[model samples]
Target: MARGEPVTVEPVVGEPAAVADLGGERALLVADVHAGIEVGLRYERGVELDSRADARRERLCDLIRETDADRLVVLGDLAHRIGAPDGDEREELAALIRAVTDRVPMTLVEGNHDAGVAEAFADELDVIGADGGVLDGTVAACHGHTWPAPALLDADVVCTGHEHPQVRLEDAVGGSRVERAWLRGDLDPAAFTEAGTEADLPDDPPELVVFPAFNERSGGTWVNVEGQSFLAPYLPAALPAADAYLLDGTRLGEYRRV
Candidate 1:
């Protein structure tokens, strides 16, 4: 509940989720919901997908109720499509939103995948733009896929859900496993210089926090690897060095980079 400390909750295996305790009021923070992920996979990539949307929603709702959080902060990628929400997806998303909003304040931080869909649910939710906005106690939430705005950098603590950071842990069989993780580190000031956005760099890099993607289909952009540009800025040795927190339900631990 204190600064730099997150009370962790472990969800079932294969269920991607996490919660952050913010003092008296807890924050049910989830990322990359990608509401219509199955539809996108099917229509765009020709992959037959099955998403347990109902079950997942119910589980998430149960968690929220259990935590007694004052609000739910969806980090980003609430919707999968860029333009419109399909029939089934729209209904499911609406139902899910309604179910949560009925109980507590639900805020959405727009992600790249959440363009027009926000307007569709504007009446039912408080949707923040890419620039994001501040909440209680220096807490700023945003979808971390894009460059952060100057204002966000000035917040006491910045939280985002882009990059879907994951760490590779090998099983006994030597097979690799990837679990959704949170990257907690200071903002890299050098990233701006590298991207030629030095003029935009903040006087000081704020404490950086990256939430894991809530959508199961969305893994992570492997940092520490070459030719993978999506998460280059968040990588260590970059301006604002970041650390990784691998989340498996209530169990949260430091992710050792290999």
Candidate 2:
């Protein structure tokens, strides 16, 4: 694929979600869709978090249909719990996948949260890998959790959604704050090593592109926190330095490093 211009970030109203348009044929890139996260949060954490998931699904379907995209690429976290797949959750997710697949081709990339559940529904959907899958020419997609292999970076644009990256803002008095900021930056290999659960990352970080999480309950983490590291190794260097775009429903803002 011919090298396209840099990624364009756009936000959707209602749920305050953002998406990247890759300037490709019939493709809408997305990531970090923890399908059953709400159920799990309620079950385990006892947090009665709520969002219009069904409505979001409908809007997403509408977006796919209206955009006339032939494919929907999910970067990762297709499911919530690791290695746990309840029948009800599986059925609900399967139905959602079927609905979207009915409108456009759906591609699922595995993330840390996706282990047994994602594979279980693979037969009903197209499952891509972290190594990368060629979308058209050089355009490739993967879950940015693991270090992207060399081949992935060769693509014109690589899309992944594992960080669930967000920017935190505070008032002058440091009382009021706002989240839901869109994050866009170059891919760095170093940020992946900082995860507390995992130590060490690949020697070279690929040209990274991180996407915000789709699940509302999966709160976004402040990228600059002391020990709260991101799955993408190069995030620290890429962010607040490289091009970063924050979106609020078609409104885009350039982020200045704090």
Candidate 3:
């Protein structure tokens, strides 16, 4: 693929989602869909709630249809928990993955929470490295928990998802709400060069796009607030002037930690 060729990245409307239209390599990118989170809520937080696995599966299927994507790239955390999946969790995850894969190809970039996932989904899908994977051989993606492999930094654009970025909005009545938001900015090429990979960066450096958690129940970082720590390793160095946008393509401008 030509490095100079422009690819279109847009947010999927009527939902908290995004997609990168790479011509024949079109893909829908979503992050941090912590399947079986309801299990955690019940067991850990002691909250009684119905399982949302069916709802999540339907939401994902609908988004896939809307985007008309040939492939689905999950940024990471395809399942909850740090260890192996239990019977209930495995069933929910398997069902969701089966539902999507039955329609189109799926790739799960390993996330911090994705341990034992490779074995779990071995027959259904190929679980890629935590370091990241290249989409359409152009855009590089990682789950944002660790330093990405040097190879992943050489793509036209870098995408990551571990942050689950969100912005805080307060109304006149002193009530505040946090909504999922997409974070977009350019990376500094000099940083890559300084790391002794000067030739790896393109003449025009790639932009960085951080995806919000796809699971609605997953709590997110208050990105626009003061003293909020960023979780991604490359984030502090990239110093992304993160512009927050809703899924409807409404631009909220640059959101900086206060």
Instruction: Please give the CA lDDT of all the candidate structures.
Output: 0.67, 0.61, 0.80
- Could you give the C-alpha RMSD of every candidate to the true structure, in order shown? 4.2, 5.1, 2.5
Winner by lDDT = 3
Which is superior by TM-score, 2 or 3?
3
lDDT of 2 by residue, 1-258 (tens): 234554444444433343444445556666777777777778788887664457657866887766566677777777777776776567657767888888877777777777775567757777766555656545667676665555554554456677776666666887855355455545544443334534333343334455667666677766544566666654555454443444443323444442
Score residue 240 of candidate 3 by CA lDDT.
Answer: 48
Poorest 10 consecutive residues of model 1 by lDDT?
1-10
The positional error of residue 31 in candidate 3, measured at the CA in angstroms, is 0.6
Model 3, residue 105: C-alpha shift (Å) = 1.4
- Candidate 3 Cα lDDT to native: 0.80
- Kindly report which residue stretches of model 3 are placed more than 4 angstroms away from their true locations once superposed: 1-3, 189-203
Give the lDDT of residue 237 in candidate 3. Answer: 64
Alpha-carbon error at 172 in model 1, in Å?
6.7
Q: Distance (Å) between predicted and true CA of 11, model 3? A: 1.4
Per-residue accuracy of model 3 over 208-233 as CA lDDT, tens digit each:
88888988888888888887888886
TM-scores for the candidates: 0.80, 0.77, 0.91
Instruction: Arrange candidates by TM-score, descending.
Output: 3, 1, 2
Model 2 residue 37 CA deviation (Å) reads 1.2
The TM-score of candidate 3 is 0.91
Off by over 4 Å in 1: 1-24, 171-173, 189-205, 224-226, 231-240, 249-256
